[model samples]
Target: MSELSIFSYLPADDPEVLEQLQDRIELVRHKLKFVELVPTVACISSLSPLKLAGGLVPELIRLAGGTPVELEDLAAADPQYIIVALEGSPLNTAMSEVETLMALPGWESLDAVKNGRIYLADGEGHFSDSPAGIVETIEMIGEILNPKQFAFGYEGEGWIKFGV
Candidate 1:
């Protein structure tokens, strides 16, 4: 669990709010536990230099029924879905960044690209490190990864999926 990160952003003295958020997150996790398809997913935190995410993001992916693609093995990982959420970037800016990422040499070679399973998230609110945002991010990714099984109404605002 990323309780440390979520709790740090919240009030240190207010344990009640933290406890409630934790319980909510656990409920979401339990629901995702029976998910049928655990797809490979890669989360990109940067665009200019092509920096992939690590640390807490991957744990959230696992909880949302996905296997986080290894940062060092992007090509071989063949991730089924890719989420790009540059920090401080809104949905529009993230869309532009997705265009930049698509221009990379082997971008189309990935399974995600070929299948049009790529997604762009709003960084400011959707993928932030705050307690409530963290829980929403899980639902956002869960809806993207398992459309048939889960939908927390984060489709248009929090994230937008690109379909080819």
Candidate 2:
């Protein structure tokens, strides 16, 4: 995967940049050691309940020391954190989906919903099918799962807190 390629590159082919990247990676690793072992899920329900599986999203969740919950297990898993990707921006299509999910039967009983951990992500640059997008998605997931350890300042870039 191209996102995984970041590990193979030398950080812009510059010694200084490479060193900085390595340092940042090490810091993230150190912080991941303290990440709470919580169940997490990422889904793109633009058409159907298509959950992220065997891709960068799951890898990112694992890197953040979170338990990646599969779609089949979501109903029974009661995930603590949920990353929802929509076909458009949060203000438009995404917000509608969030509201639809919120209206589902017993949806409010989920841990993610009850605790306000349902994050809304964009489908374009934020959750694209490219490697760079995956990297950004990982960074965002890291910030969401362990803000103290992985504060990459993803306020309005890849995702935002889900709100009514």
lDDT of 2 by residue, 1-27 (tens): 442554554345677866765566556
Please give me the total number of clashing residue pairs in predicted model 1.
Answer: 0
lDDT, candidate 1, 1-164, per-residue tens: 45456546554577898777777667767887777778899898788777777656777787678888876455777789999887767888888765688776578799999898999898878677677877788788888988877778988898998764
Which residue runs of candidate 1 sit more than 4 Å off their true CA positions? 1-12
Cα lDDT listed for each candidate: 0.78, 0.63
Inter-residue clash pairs, candidate 1 = none
Cand. 2 Cα-lDDT: 0.63
Tell me, by lDDT, which candidate is best: 1
Candidate of highest TM-score: 1
All-Cα superposition RMSD per candidate? 2.4, 3.8
Q: Could you tell me how far off, in angstroms, the CA of residue 136 lies in candidate 1 after the best superposition?
A: 1.3
Tell me the number of clashing residue pairs for each predicted model: 0, 1
Candidate 2: pairs in clash: 3-131
How high a TM-score does candidate 1 get? 0.85
